[model samples]
Target: IAARLVISQRTAQGHVEHILSKLGFTSRAQVAAWVVEERQSSS
Candidate 1:
């Protein structure tokens, strides 16, 4: 993921933290599940 994003490890970590906070989720797994559900509903 870091190679694809072309960002440093620290930057990736910060992005993950921001994403979690923005989505009101405390766990990465929860965010992943929500994203999946969203995509499914949209499709």
Candidate 2:
């Protein structure tokens, strides 16, 4: 994500942390699952 965004690794990690907290998710796996679900629904 950092490479794609042209940001530092720590910045990417901070964004992930913000997302997790905002979404009330406790794990990356849960975040991944939510992303998949969102994509499927959007499609």
Best by TM-score: 2
List, residue by residue over 1-43, the lDDT tens digit for candidate 2: 9999999999999999998999999889998899999999999
Q: Could you give candidate 1's per-residue lDDT for residues 1-43 as a string of tens digits?
A: 6678999889998888898999899889998899899999999
TM-score of each: 0.62, 0.67
After superposition, the stretches of candidate 1 with alpha carbons farther than 4 Å from their true spots are: 35-43
Q: What CA RMSD would candidate 2 show? A: 3.0
Worst 10 residues of 2 by lDDT: 18-27
Worst 10 residues of 1 by lDDT: 1-10
Which predicted model would earn the best lDDT? 2
How does model 1 score by TM-score? Answer: 0.62
